[model samples]
Target: MSATRLTVGWVPLTDVAVLIAAAERGFAAREGLDLVPVREASWANTRDKLVFGHFDAAHMLAPLAVATTLGLGHVALPLVAPFMFNLGGNAVTVSRPLAAALAAHGGLTGDLADAGAALGAVARERLAAGQGPLTFAAVFPFSTHAYQLRLLFLAAGLDPERDVRLVVVPPPFMVDALRRGLVDGFCVGSPWNSVAVDQGVGTILLLGNAIVPRAPEKVLAVPAERAQAPEIAALIRALAAAAAWCATPENRADLAALLAEPRHLDAPAEVVRRTLDGALVIDGAGTVRSDPDFLLLGANRPEPRQADWLADAMVAAGHLPQDAGNAARAVFRADLYDAALAARTRG
Candidate 1:
């Protein structure tokens, strides 16, 4: 078969499992595709490459596709996410001193509500003490990490904008930023948080699942015109197959090793294994917490509910206009996912 050629842009996080596997495993070949998975330096670079024809599709954050549709951060190019790669794979990590402070002040816990309420109290104390608000970093203005942290603060009655400052720090530099006190805490996707904790410079406070269970994280995104192409289905099926392989217990170590290659995440295999198994090593003492369903790389479906919630969060955060809800639905392309997966199931 003459395979269709396509290039995909991706960052080096574990969430790029689908893209990596599709190309590295036999999935892409089986799908009649010459899939070139390109590693990008940053999310912005990934987005720009996808938007500027450098890539045919991308391993993209779900919220970034919605925000791109509404022209929130960059050019108003309508992107479509026909398959969500996975869900629930982000974490909020804070500097050890900050974590210690929160713990000492009756705020630190595994429970989201209890931890959030505790953090809210700490935020108030920082303000009262004439110290600047604690800084929190997210990868981008339109990322799930930002949304997760925002939701955590909102639920606890803390104003995310006023009580604490939110900043943008690329995932690779997140640990360094925290270590240097450039940011007190950060919400970033896996591998990075594990790296931070492994380095003993940071402590993970909450997993994204704890904040909002099964919240959409990454997706397979392309320009709207390509969403319905026949190859789109092939690629979707390939990605779904890759994700299924990645979720298997025996493949976890292999996945970590593949991801730890120099061009990929470049982190320790042990750290990547922890994330794959949903067992986070939280502190310098190597305390591991088993978090069930950390990464939802299950049946391939992009739920509109997630797009709606993300759009609503964007609106609430003043990143998008009121009409963003409508844009999110158009951008998410749940129907396309159904069409592709259903066709694959029939075959």
Candidate 2:
């Protein structure tokens, strides 16, 4: 007589689209599901809640899932993602003061490599002048945001750990943190970077796609046993359809409306619109860059190759002791996606 109720967790970010659309647009309802999305303050909160059984699934950072399963940053709990929600929707932003410094030191080049090289030069100069390493924040220790930031520094021949202080800051608070001088720069998913630019607190450095194009972003993550639930297929299908809807240009306005709900991203539809369209306003003065593949949804799947890539980066960044190959493959669960989608096709 009643729809199946399932509680899930998500942070306030642009990539939470599929989940919100699935629930709000009746996709979850058609699947006989009453999806309850619980808002979380941070990725750590989402991970902890999932482990504590407070969530049936979570819109989670891809690497956080692998990290949890591999015991890299949390208690070992093998999670699986049958569906990846989106890919490559992140950016690096620096405070106005730091942006000015970087610009003055030739760090504002549009090229990722040239920019990083110039930033490395500035970092060296600041350190020699006793300013030491600049502080940079990411949403999670084990997220693509972190790895992408490190890779940007790596390309410049500057060690991320030595040239900058890495820290964790929640997405909703990134702009304020940068404004307050808590962090000099941050690598975060949309539309937080847009929010910072809109607020005039930070200047966009580079989109994450410049560092790792098509980098895996969020996934629909659940514990190992939950992956086997019969309802997972319908749920994932609904989300996949929702992702397709979000990817449509005609639906951008509506999609932005869905995400701009008071309890969801809670930001301006215009800002959300820019992020969805990849027409990013890189600075407060309104410079725009059109990046069509800034975020991939719709046909996005949980690829083990993505997991393996992130795992290798984690090890290289000294976040993991070993390769975590097996753990990554297990958690990625492309097999589950194949099975679920196949069953849906058969039906």
* TM-score on alpha carbons, each prediction: 0.96, 0.97
lDDT tens digits, residue span 1-347, model 1:
68899999998898887789889989989989999999886889999888888999998888888777667658977899989888888989989988988888565577887778778878888889999788999999888899888887886678887888999988899999998889999999998999999888998888888888888888888999787899988898888888899888898888889988888889998888888899999888888877868876764687778878888887888887886577777887878878877898898
Error of 1 at 109 (Å): 1.5
Give per-residue CA lDDT, model 2, range 1-347, as digits (tens): 58888888999999899899999988888777888989998999999999989899999998888888777756888899899999889999999888888788677765688678777888888899998798899998888999988888887778876778899998899999999999999999999999999988999999888888899889888999878887787788778778888888999999998898788989999999999998999887789977898877775677768878877887887776684566677788778878877876887
Candidate that scores best on lDDT: 2
Candidate 1 residue 32 C-alpha distance from true site, Å: 1.1
lDDT of each: 0.85, 0.86
The lDDT of model 2 is: 0.86
Pairs of residues at least 3 apart in sequence or in different chains that clash in candidate 2? none
